[model samples]
Target: MNCLLFTWRKGDGKLKIHEVRKQLTTPLGAPAYPWGPYNFRNREYLNILYRTDMEALRRVVPEPLAIDEPLVKFEVMYMPDAPGLGAYTEAGQVIPVSFNGEKGEYLHAMYVDNHPAIAVGREVSAYPKKLGAPRLYIDSDTLVGTLDYGSLRVATATMGYKHQPMDLALARQELSQPTFMLKIVPNTDGSQKVCQLMRTQINNPTIHGAWTAPARLQLFAHALAPMADLPVLEVISASHIITDLTLSKPDVIYDYLAEH
Candidate 1:
C-alpha cells in the first residue's frame, strides 16, 4: 500500500499537513474574512429613490417583506477605506419594505468590483452580489455612478453634489435603520440548501455630511442584471451623503427552508 500527502499553498510558502488553515468563512473557506475592523471612512453615497410599478415590484420581494411604498433606491457608493473589503465601489438596488411591522430596506441586486466583497456579502449578509464594474466619481459638478456589465452599460445615475443641505440629525436617524435580504442557496439537486430572510444593520453610523439634490437615473434592460424590471414611474427623492459606519453581524429573521 502507498500513502499520499496533500498540501495547500499560501503566500510565498506552503502549508504542512499538521498546520490548520485559517477559518475566514464557512461557505468559501479560508479566504473570506468573517470578522473585520469592518469600518468605512469618507464613504460617499448617492441615493436616488424612484417610484416603480407596484405589480412589478411585488414579484421580486420575498415573503414577510411587504411593500411599504412603490419606491426603489438606486445607490452608488465609493468606499475609500473599507477595513475588510478594501477600497471598492458598489452599486445596487434596494427596495423600500416593511418587515415584522418595522420599516426597512431590502437588497434586491448588488454589483461590486472586488471578489472577496461579493463572497462575504452573499454568505454572511445574504446580499445578492455579482461581479461587475461600478464606479462613483465626480464629473464636473455632478456626482456620478455607472455600472457596466461586460461591455454593456447597465445603469447610470447623476446628481448635484451637496446642492441642498439636509438636517444632520434627521440624516443620522435615517441611517441607523436595519436592512433586510432574502438569501437562497441552491443544492446540487436544484433544491434549496439554505433559504431565509436576513436582517443586517449598519451599526453606529456617523453621518459627517449629508445633502439633498435633484437627480436623474437611467436603467437599461440587460438579461444579466435586469435593472429595468422595476420600470420607474416617478422620481421621488435623491440625496448624497458622506458617512462612517460599521457593518454589523446579521440575524436570521425568517427561515424559508425550515419545517413547519
Candidate 2:
C-alpha cells in the first residue's frame, strides 16, 4: 500500500502534490520515512556520565519534567556507515529526567554532520538536532570527540577505551530504555506552530562490546548555542559501547497548544 505525504488545494483549482513514502516508518501518514536505514557494524561510542549542579540542571531542563539526579551524559558516536544516511559523527548531551513519575532520558542538544539525519530526527522524534561538524576518533588508548560550530569548538569529551569491561546486561538495559525530547516548530508568521513532548524507545539494539572508565566533559559558551549552561560538577562514569540501534516509533505525550 502507498502512503500520501501532503496535499494543498491551489487557488480555486484542485491540483495537488503527493509524494510516496520511502523509508520504512513514518509519522502516521507523513511522507517522511523512519530515521536510519539503520545497520551499524562496530559503531563506537565514547560516553561520559557526570554530575552537575541542581541549579544549573534546573535552568537547562524544561518545566513539568523534573531532574532525577542532576546527572548528564555526554556521548560521541562514530558511525562509519548507517542505512539511508551515510557516514557521520554525532555528539550530544542527555539529562536524566522524570515526567509524570516515569523516568526517561531527555535529549538536550545533538549535533551531527549529516543534514538528512538532522532533518529526519527532527521530523520523526522532535529531537533537538542541529547541524555541525562533529568528529569521534581513537588516538592510542584515548577516545576523543569534539563538536565544532563553524570555527568555534563548543564541546569536547575524552575517555579511556575498554579500560574495564561492563556488565552487558546492565549496559543493554540502560541503552534500551525510553528517551524523551521536546519537539517544537514555528509557523511562517513567527508563531509557535507545534510544541509537544515526544517519547521514543530503542529497538532491537545488539551490544557487541561494552567498556567503562573515568571520563571528562567540557562545554564552552557559544554566542549561538550555550551548552555550557549545564555545568559539570563531578564525573560519575565513562563508557564505550559498540552496538546497533534502530530508531523506533515516537509517541507524543503532551501538546502545549491543545485546548482543554
lDDT of each: 0.85, 0.80
Candidate 2: list runs displaced more than 4 Å: 1-37
Which ten-residue region of model 2 has the weakest summed lDDT?
14-23
Q: lDDT tens string, model 2, 1-260?
A: 23343455557464344332333444446534444545766677887888888898888788678887989988788888677777888888889898999888989999888876787788755878888888988879988888898889998888886789999887787787679889888999889999998888876688998988867888899976577787877899888888877667789888888975
lDDT of 1 by residue, 1-260 (tens): 23354645556376454544444555534566547657889888888989999999999998879997789999988899887678998898999899879998999999999877888888766889999899998899998989998889999999997899989886776677679988888999999999999998876778889999889999999999899998877888888889998788889999987875
Clashing pairs in 2: none
Runs off by more than 4 Å, candidate 1: 1-22, 25-34
Best by TM-score: 1
Query: What's the lDDT of the predicted structure labeled candidate 2?
Result: 0.80
